[model samples]
Target: MIRHLVLFKLNDGVVRDDPRVVEGARIFASLGEKIPELRFWECGWNVSDRPIAYDFAINSAVEDAEALRAYVEHPEHQAGVALWREFATWVIADYEF
Candidate 1:
């Protein structure tokens, strides 16, 4: 199996109560379901309790490294990533065993 982990840090000014950011999160969450390779998904706002922690984490499981690669090249996820980069500090990585 493969684990696709993404962390996002949103700029404070445009982070909370912002429709675009909110929808962006929601849309990404929805995309996970639409994509067959995605075995799981989780997302949420950053809590004040954790210092220097990311605002959100999209934790997903896929069949293999190849499936994760396909997800990265998929049109829908690609579009969302492009749009999301404009407003947040995005970081991602994946691993398998």
Candidate 2:
């Protein structure tokens, strides 16, 4: 399986409660149901307030690299990325297990 992880930091002045951010989170939260390639999905706001902490995170698994690619190219996923791109910047890492 491929474990795909992501950390997101909201752009300056963009709070989590902002409607756009909330909607973006909702979009990601719904992906487990929408994408067949997603074998696992967990995402949420970070509880820590430390300066090094990210505002949100995603931990997901897929069957393999092909499935991971499908999930990444999926239209719904692309849409969600577009929305978040407006208010956040993110980092990601993927590994096999």
TM-score of each: 0.85, 0.98
Pairs with steric clashes in candidate 1 = none
Tens-digit per-residue lDDT, 1-97, candidate 1: 8888888988767765578787788778788677777777677666765777888778888888778878888888887787777788878888885
Over 1-97, each residue of candidate 2 has an lDDT whose tens digit, in order, gives 9999999999999998999999999999999999999999999999997999999999999999999999999999999999999999999999999
Candidates in order have lDDT scores of: 0.78, 0.98
Error of 2 at 97 (Å): 0.7
Model 1 clashing-pair count: 0
**CA lDDT of 22 in candidate 2?**
97
lDDT of 2: 0.98
Q: List the residue pairs that clash in candidate 2.
A: none
After TM-score superposition, the amount by which residue 44's alpha carbon in candidate 1 deviates from its true location, in angstroms, is: 2.2
